[model samples]
Target chain A: MREPAPRSYRAPSTALVPAVELRGLVKTYDEGELSVPVLRGIDLCIEPGEFVSLRGPSGSGKSTLLNILGCLDRPTAGRYVLGGTDVSALTREEQAWVRLHHIGFVFQSFHLLPDATAAENVVLPLFYAGVRRAERERRARELLERVGLAHRFDHVPSRLSGGERQRVAIARALACRPRLLLADEPTGALDSRTGASILELLLDLHRRERLTIVLVTHDPGVAEAASRRIFMRDGRIEDDARA
Target chain B: MAARVLRRHPGRTLLTVLGLAIGVGAFIAMVSFAEGARRSVVRQFETLGTNLLRVRPGSRARAEGVRPAMPLSDADVRLLRREATTLALVVPVARRTLAVTTEAGRVHRTRVDGTEPDYARIAGLRFAAGGMFDATDLGTSNRVCVLGVTVARALFGERDPLGERVRIGPALPARVVGVVAAQGRTTTGSDLDDFVLVPRTTFALFLGATEGYSSLEVRPRSAALFEAARHELTTLLRRSHGLGPAEPDDFTLWSPEDTIRAAEETSRILGALLAAIAAISLLVGGIGIMNIQLVSVSERTHEIGIRAAIGGSPAQILRQFLAEALLLALVGATAGVLLGVGSSWIVAHAMQWPPSVSWRVVALSAGFGTVVGVLFGYVPARRAARLDPIVALRRE
Candidate 1:
């Protein structure tokens, strides 16, 4: 049996410069002496202002890849460059700083702080950015209104509707004016109509603010709506289709 | 910010503050008692006179439960009069308790201090009324007695005790020419309040023939000469008593300085013991703070996680918890200080013990409370700081 050749990573065209690039990314976890690889040699590029959707079945390394791109986890072996910074070379605090300053995350479960109001949740990124209180509040209010939740600014996560909560999460991700927005099943918890509304809001933000978006979903409609779609299978990219 | 934090968790804050107050209050109370004792000892010594020394008896051998004294013969007295250079006055005195009757027909027990006119000067005693006995009174073995303030008040019924005749043992009439000033109770609560003074010659003639004195009291001219006077008098007595250098003297000498030093030393030991006990409570209070802080960390795990995720550094988280802990301890310490100081004052005023408030004690206890807060609160604060922001945020 002949061994397979190593996959080559293609760098995106540098016209606008890629917002996120991963070369030979690998992530492994150890259970005692056993090493379980979740992401194996993932090579991907997301260009500035491009809406990309990553589609895969459960346990196919899609979320793991997203985590690496968001600077939440270090790859076991690989190079990750985001916003012209070699993220793999940065220390933990530096990585957190990068994530805080440049990347915004939206979770499938709508992870807004339960104790804080919608506006307060939106101000979280600015808090990490060390923005002064007055400025943070101003920006938070503006983003809340942008998401059509201006009247629900004082509503806590528990009080907000599913769509309202997801909108707040989106507003929070844009708080520090991050360059890239990563939404993991942004409409997973909402009804169809609300899900379509959230999807439309994300598309509107991506086009208007020139923000790069990477949406992780198993839904075909969500993936098809993106400007580019990447399909993953068994910890490897199966296909890349551009719209 | 401090006020806001405190207000946010009022119950925990108040509980912590209470613990500190109890610790501080215990410290203040213990220290005050010890301070009062020290003052009492000083007062006793001061009343006995600063320049005076008491030379009492001892044995050639260590005899347990035995009374010993150098025989104060007339010749010994004459020898002291001639050889003593540092002695401003040397009065041979004796003490015996006697039953006496007054003209008012009251019989009471009293201390009979036998001494000459200069005895009053040496003992730091002053006449509250009338006049003390003179050398002429001692020479004639005058049956003149001086009533102490307590004795006079008890026997005379608010009447003038001066020139009144009092009957001692065998109904011998001793005229009270002077009233000795009242001396309050000492630390041991002893009865130095009621006593009577008379000439040594009178004591020997009327009561019993005493060839030996109980003690020889020496008063040096100045404090500087006290040691010299003691040394000189010891040498003179040793030579007169025919004691060799190899043998222990038959008498022991006591002075205000020695008594004062001993009192101070014992007081210090007692104070330390009390402080140690109080410190144990403080330690317990510290443990209480630690326990409460640990519970707080657990209760606010989600809050801590959120703060950290939102850009609160480990340092900031640590500081916030520590601040809350300190706030609790500080409140407790403040309350304790007030209670301790106030109780000390009340006890002092009520019992007439010198209630001395030591500022150093208050400052030390407050600082101690703060230190305890920081020390005990650190482990929990660190635990809170080390929480994974992701897990914390994910937690309900």
Candidate 2:
């Protein structure tokens, strides 16, 4: 079958902007009079088509930084830019728009709506984007096929296996043709064999689509799959290296 | 999608719908019965003829401690005939409970109505055998009587006694001049077939002269003349009774139209009251909907988070939940309308009354159900919309 043409608006090719940038980012939680800081003075840049991994132990603020990067939450102090646009001063709704147009997320739990069919879950982002019903269905079917779950299009999340459910989630995350894909412990809930297959799928997608990905995990084996890796300890990055 | 969500919890959805259906059904049944009652009253008046008027001796207002007003006299009746020009006929009636025995010794006590020859025409009485006493018999104070169906059946059974004499009370015997056709009941719920009729003069001679006639049944030449005849009778009666302009009239004038209107108004008020009571149950149903919607919002918090993370706006989330609630209520209301109409039909059938389902009432109930859905659905939808994506996702 012929590949489906991208339908989303593309950024100017000559702009030369990194896919993600964060300068002196900080996050704090207020509990009455006490202030608990989660991320401290983090600076990072990720170019287009780069596959980066954030490796940290529990409570090391890797998830916090990933959330900020995905536009799910804002940092207390930061100069964050994505795809040539400064998004630090964006409102909640504006951040949501940015996420809709630029970002995709894959969680460890897959997060497929339990009652929805695989195709229906894949078509949800397009539904919010106001795409017509027929086009959404067509695109959803194509995406499911690309993820090797075309036969399971009508299967609900509950009926699908964990591996199939994860594949459906990946299809859903890519529904809007987002510029950046954020995966938090994508293989955490899978058996090692399934996790390895899922990692291979991600690497295949990265090469085939020229996609930029940021993977967060504590597993060294998972981090090793990324072309570049950053190590964090105590809410601060301790090292960054490229293979 | 919204339907699928509801389908996930079939028990909750069915319970909510059943609650609403019961409420609507009750409202429909009450409205139908009340309408039937109103229609029955109108039919009753129609049978009695709308052009007829009843004159009785009592003012609309009478204090409890005051002595009862005197009965209308024969002189007052003569005076009304001479003065009231709009009246086509005046039929004086004198009623008393009397014991009558047949020659075969069958005895029964029943109401005896002493009236004029014109009373047959005014009261819409039809003869089953023989005929009413003419002017000659009434003028001579003949000892003749007409027996209603109930009286006739009790005194003679299947035997025809057109010329037989039956002893009435302890005073005198009267020949049966006619047998009245069966008239089940009057508009006032009195048994019409349970009485006998006698000439007014003969009744006066036997029962002794009272201060006045018991009542007067009057007819206008045409229905259009009823209001004029009523006004003229009222004026003449007031003037003859010597009442001042400031004093209330001592006589009450009732038209069939007035009685029918009053009955209709009363039923309308009662119907509204019953509908309001039924609506309380609907309100309870609405509360049930709200309770279940809240539970659904809480249960689907993770799903809501996922949608939000995938570009679902708060408005969209709000709309989805609201749609689910609205769909539930609308479906329930439709079922309720069917239930209500069906139950009303059943009740009407059981009672042998005509079912009266007004389309306006059905539409109003459906609209009310929809309003309830929107009102009760709001709080839960808002809660779902305001959910913080990060917290909601973390909840699981």
Candidate 3:
């Protein structure tokens, strides 16, 4: 096997550049002539390997902030930087490229492709990353093993349980070895026991891999598991604290 | 993945594929039949000999309205033989519908053609029994006739007809001296084995002296000399008839090449018209595919969101749907070709016509099906590709 090449987008001096930096980021939705603002003037910075949780109520825009951070949506105004790159001004195509190379996302509902097996789901991001078939399958197998679902590699999402599906989604999110992992209510639909286990898995993965994680959740118990927590109300950050 | 997604909706995929198959099948069947007809015409012409030419009287509108065109006379035939050096032989033919009665009183209405002994050679006539009229029979103007296979079967049944006499319509009975070989339907759909042949002198005696010849059949010495012989015959006939430079020659020249060209042109136009009609059904099938694809996109909106979030670009999403559509079309096209060839074979067998399927026609139908798939699949694919991941993920 050939050695993997270094990423061109990574900064020459990695210590000076934070994993994520946002300066007055704002998001608004336009419904006909009405303009409803979602995220209003958010300012934050996250160092590499920090596990940060965004805590808020249902309408507090925590999910919206996570979407922007995942590069799935653009901020209407203000600068957003990811790994020293100014992503706020990027086009939709360029943002997709950045997401493919640098960011991974796990959604509230798991969103596993119902028709695909767990391994196939994990291999999808690698497919877009232009990885060869053998390498993709190898990586998918390793990631499924990492998530403790190695035996469930061939089980499709429809056949898997809620917790198993969430594990598969987490495995898929890590397939490309992204710099940042973004989770929005990842355990929202699980029972407490299953949710707690999923959180433990995430914490273990974070510590072992030194992964930068930005998790959004409404439950304070879930937020407390992170190394840093930012509390939001009415689309603005109300409190910030570090463990 | 595209195949897996399509397999999720088996019923819709089958229905769409069936629609495309039917359209493509109809196209192939019609084109193959038309091609068969064209090949049949060319084959008939080839058997009759391409070096042969026919001269017919040209018609024109007169002050008294349309009238029968002036027919060729014995003098024109003589003049053509004398002046046209490229000529091999010329036979003047006159036709009349006559009721023939056997000695046993069996009567059959049939076409009777009057010509010389050389008519058999020029017309590629073969003998199934006794040969055509010999030189003595023509020289003496003997009241003898040659019966076509159909006429002989109708008049004589199983008995030998070589020496049997058949009475012409209100004329003296003529002896059957020969039986011509069986020739099937001509390119014009006429039965060739339904006529009788007799000497021109005997026919003229029955019709009276002033009756003119219907047409003249000429054979060139070689295939390469046909055009030259035709030109020479035209010039000779024009001068002999005393026509001025401005006066139109009152004759029409026809050859096998001209006949084949005209037949092919007509069939081409007819084939195009049929193909266009068949294409409507294909369009309808394409619309059916589009409708199903649109429904699939809407149904898989969340799946689209998940893919987008995981780094599948819009172009990749578009390609996935397009591949599904294309796979459906290709499968339909293959099945359609088989159905088309099979049905055409059945029809050809039932109708006793030769079955013909060309590779070009198959290629055209398959290519057309693929084009329809891509054309109709574009809108749905674009819609799926353009979906906003945020909104799509938020949907229930």
TM per candidate comes to 0.82, 0.85, 0.85
lDDT of candidate 2 over B191-270, digit per residue (tens): 77998899998999986766677799999878888788888888888788877787787778888889899989999999
| lDDT values, one for every candidate | 0.80, 0.86, 0.85
B326 Cα displacement, candidate 2 (Å)? 1.0
Most TM-score-accurate candidate: 2
**TM-score between predicted and true chain B, model 3:** 0.87
lDDT tens digits, residues B1-396, model 1?
A: 445656767787777777767787888888887887788788789879889878776664676644455576666667877988988877788878888898667988888888888888787777789878888888999889998888888888798888889998664689989997777887777777588888888888888865588778888878889889999888878887877787677777788888888988988999999989888888788888899889878877877765665445566677778877777777777888898898888877776777687999988987887788778888888888778766676676
The lDDT, on a scale of 0 to 1, for candidate 2 is 0.86
* DockQ: the better of candidates 1 and 2: 2
Give DockQ for candidates 1 onward, in order: 0.13, 0.39, 0.44
Ranking by lDDT: 2, 3, 1
Query: Judged by TM-score relative to the true structure, which candidate is superior, 1 or 3?
Result: 3
Encode model 3's per-residue lDDT on A82-198: one tens digit a residue.
888799987766777778778888877898887789999998888877788999889988999999999999998999999999999999988877889998888899998999999
For residues A77-171, could you state the per-residue lDDT of candidate 1 as single tens digits?
A: 99998866688867655655666667788878877767678988898767655677899889988998999999997888999999999999888
Misplaced by over 4 Å in model 2 are A1-8, A12-15, A131-137, B26-35, B57-69, B98-110, B125-132, B140-193, B201-212, B220-252, B343-356
Candidate 2 global Cα RMSD:
4.3
Categorize the docking of model 3. acceptable
Question: Per-residue CA lDDT of candidate 2, range A136-205, in tens?
Answer: 9999889999999999989989999899999999999899888899999999999999999888989998
Model 3 clash pairs? Answer: none
